[model samples]
Target: MPELPEVETFKQYFESTSLNKQIKNIKIKDTRILSIEENIFINTLRGKKFNSVTRHGKYLFVECNSFFLVMHFGMTGDLEYYRRGEEEPKYSKVLFEFTNNHILSYISTRMFGKLDITDDYKKYINKNRLGPDALTMSYEEFLMSLKRRTTNVKTALMNQRIICGIGNIYSDEILFRTQINPLTKINILQEYQLKELFTNIKEILKYGIRKKGNLATYSSKLIIPHRIEEENCPICHTPIKRYEILGRHGFFCPTCQKEN
Candidate 1:
């Protein structure tokens, strides 16, 4: 799944390559991948210029001159930018052809990505009840958001209504960095611990974005590294531990992130 950092990276790319380009056509290869009717989606975007691209949580908003195109990269979804005469890949599920010969492609191997149209983005976001994005949420706001939730700390972190853009991977990394057990009750957190957790969340997210999410790369690579067994904890020398909770894989260092 593309997390917050990955989504932000895509937003920057979209801004650079596709902004202000007038859409000449909207092509959908699979009807199941669209949230709105194919004709309506095509009609809404055909003539509008892409004003900007914004991201909230795991969703991307391509704002046109008059409306917003909602995109959710369900699991294996990504975007590609190519020029005219460049062959569109077999996986380019949806392509937005621009008047300037640039094409913005949405590719999803699993067919889970979504494309929809909306006149009001704010209303749609609110209706989805997503909390403030993890990248921009203030410390006080983050603390309050978690404190109000009664679920397990890990579950609370994953709850979109409490804080946005944190998925299984980042949640594990955050808890490991803060030295908090995944199963700990949310209300049991100490004030200082919450403060530390806030710092770690911001640090991890920001660092991930800067690295272009490259978990492991040879040179100038941007990918999110998935910590697994036998890997050393970046902060401490403890061996990384892997566990399955609620059927989701989580990683931690027992010596560093002691259960509390």
Candidate 2:
């Protein structure tokens, strides 16, 4: 799934490549991903110019003259830009052709992503009841959200209702970096531990952004504990362990994040 860092990367890509371009045409290879009627979606965006791009959590909003085109890269979504003679990606669900003949392709191999048209981004976000974005949320806000939550710390972090943008992968990384066991009860966390959690959340997320969401490309130490099964911990040489939490696998160094 495209989490905060990956979505942020896409937002940058969308801004740089697609903004200010006039939509000459739209090719809908799969209408299953469209949230609006096919004709309505096509008619609304066919000739409008892309004004800007913004992101909240994992959603990308492409501003046009009349409305915003919202995108959610569900599990295996990606965007690619190519000019004439370049091959379209294998699972491209939609294509936006600009006046200059360049194309922005929305590709989703598993067809889990979605595209929607809306007039107000804020209204849409409010209607969906999404919490503040994780990257921009303040430490105070993070702490407040944890109040009264008795769920495991990992579950709390992954809850979009409490804080948006974090997913299974990043939540695991956050807990690992903070040396918090995934099974720790949220209400049992100490004040200092909460502060440390907030700090690690910001650091790990910012680091991910700087690396363009490809931790593997940056350094083995950055992703080894999460990317490999049975791999030795980079920090302590202890074998990394995996735990099933909320139907997702979370990796951690047992010695580093031992439950108390």
Candidate 3:
């Protein structure tokens, strides 16, 4: 799934390529990837210009002067900007044709991406109940969000209601850096550890954003790069382990991130 960093990259890309371009047409190849009716979606963007692209958690909202086009890149969603004569992506479900002879294709291999139009994004956020974005949440705000969580710390961190913009991949990185086990209960940790956890959440996620979420290209101690090789932990030389949570895979070094 595309997390905060990946989605932020997408937002930046959308801003650079699609902004200020007049929407000449909106084409929908699949009905499953749209949240609104096809006609409404088409009419909303017709003759409009993209002003900005904003990201919250895993969602991207393209701000037109009159409305926002919501984009939720569900597991394998991506955007491709190419000339109109070029072949659209194989999985292009939605294509935005511009008067400039370019097209922005919305691609989702798994048919899970969503497109919708909203005049008020705050109402959309509230309706979905997403917590504050991880990048901007203050320390106090982080603690307050976690106050209601009784589950394991890993699960708490992954909870969208507590702190949006974290998923299985980043959750494992945050916990591993903090040396906290995925199964460690929230109340079992020390106050100092809790503070550290919040700190690492921001630090690690910021690192991801800086890297543009390309885990494989970089050489780091992060478990993500090693997951493909099934290698030993760089810090402790212990074998990295994988666990399934809610049908998602999380990787960690067992010796380093032992349960508290």
TM-score winner = 3
Question: What's the C-alpha lDDT at position 12 in model 3?
Answer: 82
Q: What digit string (tens of lDDT, one per residue) describes model 3 on residues 36-86?
A: 888989988999899988888888888987699999988898989999889
Minimum summed lDDT over a 10-residue window in model 1 is located at 217-226
Clashing pairs in 3: none
Q: Rank by TM-score, descending?
A: 3, 2, 1
**Model 1: runs farther than 4 Å from truth?**
218-226, 234-236
Error of 2 at 105 (Å): 0.3
Give Cα-based local distance difference scores for all models. Answer: 0.81, 0.87, 0.86
lDDT value for model 1:
0.81
What TM value does model 3 have?
0.96
Clashing pairs in 1: 213-223, 213-224, 214-222, 214-223, 215-223, 215-224, 215-225
Query: Which digits, one per residue and each the tens of the lDDT, describe model 1 over residues 183-216?
Result: 8888888989888888888888887788676556
After superposing candidate 3, which stretches have Cα over 4 Å from the reference? 228-230
Give residue 109's error in model 2 in angstroms. Answer: 0.5
